[model samples]
Structures are given as C-alpha cells and as structure tokens.
Target: MAQESKPVAQVDVRNIGGIDEASVTLPEGVSILTGRNATNRTSFLQALMAGLGSRQSSLKGDAEKGEVTLVLDDETYTRTLQRRGDSVSFDGDPYLDDPELADLFAFLLENNEARQAVARGDDLREIIMRPIDIDSIEAEIRECKREREELESEIEKLDSLERDLSDLETDRREKVESLEAAREELESVNDELDELDTGIEESQTRKQELENAFQRVRDARSKLDNIEFDLETERSTLSELKAEREELHETIENAEKPDENADRLAGRIDELRGRKRSLDDDINELGSVINFNEDLIDGSGIEIYEGTPSDDPTDALNADGQTVCWTCGSEVGTDQIEATLDRLRELRSDKLDERSEIRAKIQELTDQQSSIREAEREIERAQERLTAVETEIESTESRIADLEDQIESKQEEIEELEQDAESIDVEGYDESIKLHREANEIELRIERFKDEIEEIDDEIDKREAAIERREELKSEREELASRLTELRTRVDRIEETAVEEFNEHMETVLEILEYENLDRIWIERRETEVREGRRKVTRTRFELHIVRSSSDGTAYEDTVDHLSESEREVTGLVFALAGYLVHDVYETVPFVLLDSLEAIDSDRIARVVDYFRTHADYLVTALLPEDANALPEEYAYTESID
Candidate 1:
C-alpha cells in the first residue's frame, strides 16, 4: 500500500552521548551532500543511508567504525548499522539476510524516487510503496506474556514438604513409659521378698530354744523319784521293835504268881526282864515314827492316824520310815529304850527330811515338767509353724517362679513390642522420620499445585501470544484494507477521468521535445486481497501512446534510452514539470534529481526552472558548474557535486 505524498526529507546525525564524534545537520528539500567528487561525498551518501540500515544499497558499509541514527517524522530508530563482509546488520539484526522486514526496509530508499524510476527499472522500488503491518507494538506484547508462565510453576513445590514431619513424633513417646512402669513393679516385689526372709529366720531361732527347754524338764522329773524311795525304807525298821517290847512285859507278870521252883523262877524272871528290855529297845528304835504318825499327821496336816497296821499302806510316800506305839504301857529297859528312841528319831528325822526334800524336788520338777510340756507344745507348734513357713516359702518361691515366667514372657512381648516400635523411631529419630514423611507429602502437594499452575500459565501464555500475534495480523489487515480502499479510490479516479481518453489527451499535451512514451503510463489496480498470502494492493501500468525524436523519428518507451541526449533531458524536465501538478505541498518544495542532464539545452533548463518557481517555494538541484546559470535569479538553489 502507498502512503500519499509524504516523502522522506532529511537526516540529522548527532553524537548523542558526545564521545569523540562530530555531528551535522542535513537539509530538507533536495540537499546535495556536496564536497569534492572524490572527497567522500558518495561515501557520505552511503553513510547517510547507513543510518537506516536497509536503506543502504546492494553495497553497504562498515559497522565497527561508527554508530548512526535516522530521524523520521514519527520517531527516531537508532542503530550501529553496517556491513560485515557481505552481510548487512542493524543493531545486530541481520538486515540483508532477513527477507521480510529487510525487504520493507529496502523499499524506503527506492520508492522515495519517482515511480517512473520503478517503471524504468529499480530493484527495491516496487516493494517499498506497500506496507506490511500497520504497527510494531503488537509484537512486543506477546513476548512478555510467555515469561510470566514459567515463574509461577516453581513456587508450588516448596509447601508440601513441611506437613509430613508432624505425625511421626507422636508415636515414639508411648513406648518409653511402659518400660519404666515394668521396672517399678519389679522393685516392689523384691522388697516383699526381703521382709519375708527376715521373718522366717526369726521364727527358726525361737523354735530351737523351745526344743531344749522340753528336754531339761524330763531329766529333772526322773531325779526326784529316786531320792524319795531311800527315805521310806529306814522308817519301817523302827516300827517292828515296838511290838516285841509289849510281849515281854506280859510274860514277866504271869511267872511271879506260880510258886513252883524258886531258882527256876529267878532265871525265868531275868530272862523275861532282859527280853522285855530288848523288846523295849526294839520298840523304842522305831522312835517317833510309830507315835509320830499321829503327831506327824496332826502337826504336818497329813491324813494318817495311829492304829494297828494291816500289812503296809500302799499309798505311803515315806514307806522307808516305820511307825511305833510309844504310848502302849509295857515292861522295858530304859537304856535300850533310849537307844531305840534315838535311832528311831534319827530314822524319823531322815524320813521327814527325805519327804520334804523329795516333795520340794517333786514340786520343783513338776513346775519344770509343766514348762517342759509347754516347751514341747511350743516345739510342736513351732514344727507346725516351720512346716507352714516352708510351704509358704515354697508357695512364695513358686510365685516368684511364676513371676519370673511372666517376666520372661513379658520380655518376649517386650521384644515384640520393640520390633513393632521400630516404626516409631525414638531418640529424635522419630522426629526426623515424621518430618521426612511430612516433607514428602508436602512435596507431592506442591508438585501437584505446581503442575496445575503451570498448565494454566502455559495455556494463558499461549493464548496471549496468539492474541498479540492476531493483533499484529489485524494491523497488517488494517494496512491492507486501507490500501484496498486507496487503490479503489485511485481506480475510481482514473476510471472517472476516462483513463483511455486521458492517455490520448496526455499524449497530445506532452508532444513537445519528447522521444518515446512510457510503456505503461496509466495504472490499474486490483483491490482484492489474497486470503493466504501478502494481499497488498496492486497497480498495473500501461502506455496507450509512444513518443519519437523529431530528428531520427526513432521510438522508445523510456526517453532516456532511445532519444538524443538533449531530447532525453528535455523529456525528463517535462516529466518533473508534470509532477508539480500531481504533488501537493503546504509550503511547496519542488525538487528533482536527474542524472546526466548535461545534454539538455540551457534554454529548456531555464524554462523548467521558471515553471517550478511559479508553483513552488523552494527548488534545489544537483549539477556540474556549467548548469548554474540555467535557472532565473533566485528561482532555484544550486548545489554542485564533482
């Protein structure tokens, strides 16, 4: 698509940061960048276009020597544009190598010239009159949207790692308490056993003393019986002597009454007296035993009485001592009686002492016997107690055994518990395990969250990129659409002017000094777009008439090729005059560039300059020194390039 009449005018070069470079201002309106011809003016021209990188010709310049900038009507795009060994680059964009943007860039340099130059043949001229996209802003927005999608996905993974650590710590604490409780129970059982052992030792010592006391009592009882038997025999001898004294006294009285033999009577009397004495002594020998039976019974409070004995009393305690009837009146001797009495007294005393001694012994032994019996009873009880204690000890041992078995079983259970508790790692290991588990869970959640966010972000990035790209496409569409409208307007104008008829009229109007007519002077456009390709507006050029040189009558489409040198220059000047009719200017700057125009007559150049001054404010030309006088005074500004 073609921009109306705004042609690129001038460029200003500035050393912006001002680091050792010179700056200069180029003029608008047909400035000739002039110096000596070989003094770098052409290279300066190359430098001018180098500021717009693709504006350089097929031959571009060196980049490393300097940086450049171009000022356009909208904004300035600056770059270090240059060529490096057959490659063109602008701000590191490979200008010559890129076909799309580069082609559009190259079009600016060529299209700025006249369209007749394109019809006459210029390489990049045909493309620059068209636009690719209306604006470049849409391309930048797509780049930003894609970058945002990648950043959000990384944050989600960190959250899941924190949760798993909490659960593992709780299980480890319970097992330690159970082991402590078992230890306390065992301490209690050991204390109970200690107390029971002390009681059993004390009971055994007391039982031994009881057994010794029972044996001592039995020995004392046997000794008291033997001593009592000796005293009883001695008292019985004294009692028989008292009975003989009574018989002797009775015989002595009966013999005195019989008077038969006096000598025999004397002898019998002596015998009877002696016998009586003996009997008396014998009777007295029993001493107080016979008589003391009553006294002893009365004085000692015994149960025996004085009476004739019938055999011996069976229950006598003092049977070794005898009883006598001392109060029975009978003849007896005094000396013998005294002796018997003395002996009897001795026996009675012995019997009494023996009875008292034996009785005392018996009483003492009886107490001892009772103590012995009690001791025996105690021993029996102790035996029973010892038996019971042994049974208790056995039972306690059995209980201890059972406890041990239980402990063993509990130990096995503890082992099993320990095995199960392996899952509950104590000693701070549980905390680590729990933390790892929490971390793993958090990691999984974070990964899933990241995946979800990434999917959404990627989709959004792609959609935004597509939208931005569509906006660019829409800008191109708008450019193409506007071009279609402009092309349609141009077609309508041409058709309304009756292009075929206009061509005929234009031929007549241009009949002076011209050699050959253009092959295609009238333009036709096809405004329809191709759906899939560059649907740029198109124009067709046509020439319904030909021009000829008046001298040779030779014909050519481009007057520059076939006409005489002056004819060619006059025709080009005529074309420049016709362009003044077509172009509009608020402050008119009518300009042209003509190569090899030295063949034109000075009179014709004067006419062209006068024609320009009538309609324009500024007219500038590039020429050799001889061409300066061809313009009227002040009608044109003249600049010469060698």
Candidate 2:
C-alpha cells in the first residue's frame, strides 16, 4: 500500500491574534516560520494547531472573530471562533482527530512540558512521560478504584442492612407480642360489651316509657298555665265591672235632683223677662219718637205750605203765610216744633238704658235654663249606666266561677301527671346510658388495636423489602468487584507495555541525537507513599533514568536531573517524540509544531529538527531569523514574516 500524504496542505488565517489576515502554504517535509519577536509567527502556528483541533485561541481583542482554514490533500477543514461560540467544519470527512493530542505532540510552545523541562526544577520523569497516555491509564485506574470503592460502599450498606435485619426481627417479635396482648384485651372488652347489650336494650325501652310520661307531665303543666291565665283575665273583668257599678251609683245619686241654683235663677229670669218685654216696647216707642223728632227738625217729613216764612218769631199770621204740619195738617210755629222734638229725645234716651238692663237679665235666665237641661240629661245617662253595670257584674261573676272550676281541674291533672312522672324509674335509663358509653369505648379500643396490628404488619413488610434490596445490592457489589479487578489487571498490563515501548524509543532517539556520555535511557515504574493532610496516598508514576558511563569505563544509573540543560531539553523533546511514535500519534495527526527553542544551541536544534522530520510526516517550526538560518538549508522550507 502506498503511503498517504499529510492531511494539511495549506493554512489560511484571518483575524487571529496579531495577524489580521495571512495564508501560508505548507510544503512537504520540514517548514520553518522566521519572524522577529511579537511578529505573530506564534499565532500562525497556533491557528494550524487550532484548525487541527486545539482550543487555545483568542476570540477577543484584535482577533474578535477569527477563522483558520486548512487545505487538506483531499478535503478542506475550517475552525471558526466568535464571541458567542466556536465551530469546526469540514467539506469531506470530519476532523475526527483528538484535539488533546494536538496539544501534546503538535505544539512545542512556551510552558509546554517539552520546552519547560529544561529550566524547571521539578522531576523530569513526569515531563518525559507526559506525552504518552499514562495519565489516561492512571485515570482508568482511578475510575476502577472509584468503582471498587462504590462496590465496597454497597457491601458496607448490605452489611449494615443485614445487621439491621436482626434488630428488625427482634422488634417485630415484640410488636407481635404487643399486638397479641392488645387484641386479647380488646376481645375481653368486646365480650363485656356484648354481655351488656341486653341490659342496654331493656334500659333504652324503659327510658322511652319514662320520656313519654315526662312529656305528659309537660303537657298537663302547659294546660294548667293556660287555665290560670284565663282565670286571671276573668278576675280582672269582675273587678272592672264592680268599679264601673260604683261610679254609676255615685253619678245617679248626685243627679237625683236638678240644680237648686238653676231653679232660683229661672224664677229671677222670669221676672226680668217680663220687665224686659215692657222695656223693649218702650225702647221701640222711644226710637219712633226720636226718628219723628229728627225728621221734623230737618223738615224732611213735613209738607211745605204755600207760604213764605218770615224772619221774625211771630211771622205766621195767615194760612198762606204759615207752614203746615204734615201729620196734623195744622199750622205751627218753629219754636213749638223744636220744643216737642226735645221732649221726645229725652224719653228715648231713658228707654235705651232700661232696655240694656233687661237684656242682661234675660241672658242670665237663659244660661240657667241650659244648666238645668244638662243636669236632667246626665241623670238619665247615669241611670242607664247603673243598669248596664249591674248586668255586667252578674255576667263577670258567672265567668269567674267557671274559670276557677277549670283552673282547679287543670291543677289536679297537672299534680297527678307530676306524681306519675316521678314514679318512672330513671335509674335503669342512666345505667343503660353508661353501658352504651362503655360499649363505644370498647369498640374504639378494638379498632385501635386492629390499627396497631396493621401498622406492625406494614413495618414488617418494609423491613422485609429492605432486606430483599440488600440482597440485590450484595449481588451487584460482587459483580462490580469482579469488574474492578479485571480493570486493574488490564491497567497493569497496559502500563508495562507502554513503559517498555517508551524506554525502547527513548534509547533509539538518544542514540540518534548523539547525546554524549549517555549509555542508555529508560523509564522505570515507581511507587511512593505520600501524606496529603490526614490521608496517606500511594502514588504510582513512571520515572526517567539514564545510565552514564564514567571516564573509568564503568556505567552507573542516574536520573535526568544530573544532566545539562541542553541534554534535558533534548531528552524531553526526544521523549515526547518517542511517545508520539510509540503511540502512533503521527499515523493520525502526522504533524508536529515547534516554537521558541532558544534554550538549545543551533547545532542541537538542527539535530532535533532532523529527528522530528524523520518521525513526523509534516513538521512546522517557528523561530527567529537567525535560528531559522542556522538550520540545514535543504531540510527547512523557510517562511519569513515582517
């Protein structure tokens, strides 16, 4: 079968770290990136590493949005990093390669174990052995140990449950005994309640009879109360009748004779009435005279005679010259008419005074007559009232007698009912009530005992279920323990195989690099006890040791710590390369990236580069211009960055 070329053919970077946009086409064999410090050469290599599946990249600052595209022999792969997220995609097959291996073998950047091992004061064993999957083996062992611990925990739980099962059985026995006792006590109570059932029933029947008698008493009492109320009403009616009769009798006595003062006033009024009639006639005559005189004085009622009157007092001498009186048809002098008119006026004034007095006397007589009439009417009414009172008094007395008889009869009935009620035997009723209450209490006790027994049964079921679960867990624990042992054995076998391969490859690489004073290099599996706080931990690890031949031609084994800086650096590098080769990392990734190898001299760097070229299908290195220039011209395809 023909060997396949490396997957990465070209890398195009945009907005990654210090590089805004750059594209570098990778050639076959070794390639070197030549740039001064801070020239973004490391960024370019990191992009390749990222495209090959490394997470070390800046997604902020100058490289806020970055993308690295890798041109493969038959396809293209691209990785993008944005502020939100990152993604890797491919046009053909997905980049199924492990990104962790890329960090392990693909990059020799600062702080990488391969580069730091030279200057670090820590043991070189861990540094040399880092590239292999020993940590993965240790992790597997830890997982097995964790599984074993879990099995042990389950076994402990099972043991505890088994121990608890004994106690649960003991408790169950006690509960059974308690349940039995309670059931026996409840049965005895139920028997006692059953024996009292007949007595309770008989007492209940008797209680009903007594209740009926008591109800009869209550009814009789209610009837008696109604009778008493009726008697009281009748008595009140009789008293009212007597009171009305007495008042009527007094009124009749007082009205027996009319008012004497009225009679006397009537006699006086009769005399004054006769005088008043005479005076009224006089007043009328006086009024007529006064009117006549007034008319005569004015000469309104007198006919005028056909004569003229003289101014003199005695001027009337003949009928033609005299004035004639209209009533008498006689001639009269003015002096004579004046004298008659004056006399008539005086008479009328006197008659008016007498008439006023008569009218006063008549009015007094009329008032007396009215008083006499009112007294007669009162006397008649009193006599009628006295008759009515007499009739009501007889009727009320009859009703009162009837009410008294009815009340006495109701009282006798109520007394007989009360005596009968008192004769009913209440003792049997009370005894029945107490027996029923006791029966109810016994029933409750029986129910409580039943419930307790049920609870005990439930507890027993729960304990039995727990014991069954413990058995299942015991079986599971056994299976887990078997798996844990198998895993541990497998881990041991894999460790032996990996350690042997790593030592063989390191020996070969050390020889090829021409490391002086090194006879052989190998890795040894070591176990040490360490105390971390309160815990004593057994730590298993692989340590790197080298056999150095002294000037006396004798070989002795020593650790990597006694080696020089360049030797250590070379040893770490070769160890990493050996792990890569031994584990077939190159078969999948087929690439290694190296940068900042200033700790090793130029000549040694060329040898390391040459070793990498033979081992990896594709190798990329970042170095300063001078370092790039020192590499063999044909082996390095140099790329420069300004």
Most TM-score-accurate candidate: 2
* lDDT string, candidate 2, 192-280, tens digits: 64565445445667667765665676566556655666778778888888888888887777664754566677788778878876764
Query: Model 2 — TM-score against the truth?
Result: 0.40
> Against the hidden true structure, what lDDT does model 1 obtain?
0.36
Q: What total of clashing residue pairs does each candidate reach?
A: 34, 0
lDDT digits (tens) for residues 1-642 of candidate 1 = 122443453433322111123333433333332222222223333334445443332221112334555554554645463446534334622213222232222222212223223224321112222222312222223223333333222222222222322332232233334434444544554455345434443455443443233233322322322222222332333233333334434433333232234344445545545554444334322431333232222221122234442333322223533332233433334345556646665564454334333333333333334344544554456455545545554554555455455545554554454344344323333333333333333333444344444555554455445544544544554555555555445534533333333343345434432324333233222334322122332433332223433445554444235545454344334333333233232222222333223455655554544443343322333333455454544332324221
Positional deviation of 401 in candidate 2, in angstroms?
A: 91
Error of 2 at 409 (Å): 81
Residue 34, candidate 1: Cα error in Å is 5.6
